[model samples]
Target: MLAVHFDKPGGPENLYLKEVPKPSPREGEVLLKVAASALNRADLLQRQGQYDAPPGASSILGLEASGYVAELGPGCQGHWKPGDSAMALLPGGGQAQYVTVPEGLLMPIPVGLTLTQAAAIPEAWLTAFQLLHFSGNVQAGDSVLIHAGSSGVGTAAIQLTRMAGAIPLVTAGSQHKLQMAEKLGAAAGFNYKEDDFSEATLKFTRGAGVNLILDCIGGSYWEKNVNCLALDGHWVLYGLMGGATISGPLLWKLLFKRGSLITTLLRPRDKKYKQMLVKAFTEQVLPHFSTEDPQRLLPVLDRVYPITEIQEAHVYMETNRNVGKIVLNLSQ
Candidate 1:
């Protein structure tokens, strides 16, 4: 099996395909023959030695994959069999041709979706779902602000927010990205580079502020986030793209608004918690992706690259030029 490997923690140029032993299924797990996988910001961080894989997780780089069931481990329920098409939410190791996954974390590929498309679903969609429903406790009539609105998780968040009957406001750096977000159900879009998104958000809500915020850019946006958070609003922090150092009265301002600052990371969570989330997401959201639905959910894709071009894929993601998920076609 060939997997993406890095000799040292550094840039995308360090990434290369190396022959590695294929992983086998463990108890209650399934061996998947991966067809496609997706790239994420975490992958870039891990490559740069900024983030480490959780204890007992694969050291390899992908967090999600779409594949066919190859084998099932003992103690696994009879939910899947060899050759079943499935996509998995992984802690790591989806970049290779073969990887093992806990049976409970596997989801059936939505009807009418290709393997490359399904590959984009697990991590981004699940993260957005968890952020909006679980962490943010979003409610109908609520106004939610999603940063990086055209990003994989951000795009998913916009749609999910609308589904919950909440208004979704987004901030993107470019006009094209803002347009993409609007098409995906964002009620309003803000250009963070040209305008203060907090003020734009407040203006969009008629000076009432947003009821919830999905913040991926931490530190730099801390003050802005609080400024536009409604009273008792929830602010879910899942990433720190803009740096992590805070030098001011962050606590005082949040306290003033009675805001709740909740931080979460799906990759490092316990398996039981992931299983529960997967089950809930499968029941509540997976069906909408099927073609049978008139307004089916969409898994936005920006680019697809062959697994052999892992370095180029990473470079592309680093450019911050993508509007949606960047997929790696492992089958190629």
Candidate 2:
């Protein structure tokens, strides 16, 4: 099997395909014949020696993939069989041709979606679902501000927020990205590079402030996030795209608003938790993607590159040129 490899983590230039041993399924696991994998910011970080894979996880770059079940290991429940089409949220190794996954983490591909589209789900959708529901505790009628509004998780969050009857606000760097976000169901979108998003959010809500904030930018947006948070709002921090250090009275401002600061990382979470999240998402959200409803969920895809172009894909993502996911076709 060929897997994406890097000798010393540094840049996309270091990424290459090497003939590595195919992974085998362990107890309660399934060996998937991967067809496609999707890119994420975490992949770039891991490549740059910033993020490490979870303990005992595969060191390969991908965090999500779509494939067919090739084999099932012992103690696996009878829920899946060989040749079943599935997609999964992986800790790592999805970029490889063959990767093992816990059977519990596998989801049947939604009807009418190709393997390429399903490949874009798992990590992005699951993370968005987790942030909006599990971590943020979003409620109907709530106003939620999602940063990086055109991102994979951001697009997913917009739709999910609308599904929950919440008002979704977003911040992107360009007018085109902002328009894309609004088309996906955001009540309003702001240009973070040109406008004061916090002020815009406050104005959009008529100065009422947002009930929840999905913040990927850390210290750089702390004051602004606190400014737009409603009384008792939830601020969920899942990424640090900006710097991590704060120079202001973050605690003081948040305290004044009675805001709750919550931090979460899905990749490092226990298997049981991921299984629970997958089950909930499958039951509650998966069907929407297959429905005829005009507003049914969709996985936004920016581009599909052959696995051989992994370096180029990374370069594209690093430039922040994608409005959604950048997929790697493993079947090619």
Candidate 3:
């Protein structure tokens, strides 16, 4: 099995393809012959030694993949079989040609989507679903603000927010990215590098502020995010790309508005919790992908790179040049 490995994490240069033993399925798991894998910020952080895979998880870089079920482990019968086309949300080890995943994390490739496209779905879509529906409890007609709106999770969040009947307000660094967000169903988009996103959000919602905010930029956008929330609004934090330390007064505003600040990390969660999320998303959102509608939900792919070009893919991602997911075609 050829897998991406690193000796000591520092940069993308550390990553190299090496021949390693293929992983086998354990109880309640399935072995997938990986067809494709997607890149995420977490993968970059892991490569640089900033993030570590959870205990007992594979040290491989990828978090999600699309593949065919090569074999099923004991206690994993009746749901899947050999040769089944599936995508999975993995804790780690997706960068390899073969990955063992829990059965619950596997989703059949939806109709109208190729395996390569499905490869981009699991991590971004599931994270967006969890943030908007499970954590934020966003309801129809709610105004939700999403920062980094052109990111993988950001693009998914925009589509999911619209699908749930909420108005999505997005913030991106460029006009082109903002336009992409709007094309994906965001009600309004703000260029955060040039404009105050908080003020723009408030104006978009007619000075009422938004019902929820999904933010990845941490300290730099903290105060503004707090100010952009409506009374009893929910603010969900999933990443801290802009540093973690926050200063300034916030307790008073939080108290005055009865706001809730929630933070989550998906990789460290137990299997049962991930199982629940997978089930919920499959039932609630997967149907939309196959539905006969003009606004069908789908994974947005920014670019595809062969496994040999993984380093270049990382470089492109670091430049923030992608409007959606950057995928690696492992089978290429």
Q: When superposed on Cα atoms, how far off is each prediction in RMSD? A: 0.7, 0.7, 0.9
- TM-score for all predictions? 0.99, 0.99, 0.98
Off by over 4 Å in 1: none
Per lDDT, the best of the predicted structures is 2
Task: Give residue 60's lDDT in candidate 2 (0 to 100).
Answer: 93
Per-residue alpha-carbon lDDT of candidate 2 for residues 1-332, written as tens digits (9 for 90 to 100): 99999999898999999999998899999999999999999999999999999999999989999999999999998999999999999999999999999999999998889999999999999999999999999999999999999999999999999999999999999999999999999999999999999999989999989999999998899999999999999999999998899998999999999999999999999999999999999999999999575668999999999999999999999999799999999996
Task: List candidate 3 segments past 4 Å from native.
Answer: none
The segments of candidate 2 whose C-alpha lies over 4 angstroms from its true place after superposition are none
Lowest-scoring 10 consecutive residues by lDDT in candidate 1? 198-207
- On the 0 to 100 scale, the lDDT of residue 45 in model 1 is 95
What tens-digit string does per-residue lDDT give for candidate 3 at 65-153?
Answer: 99899999999867999999999999999999999999999998888888889999999999999999999999999999999899999
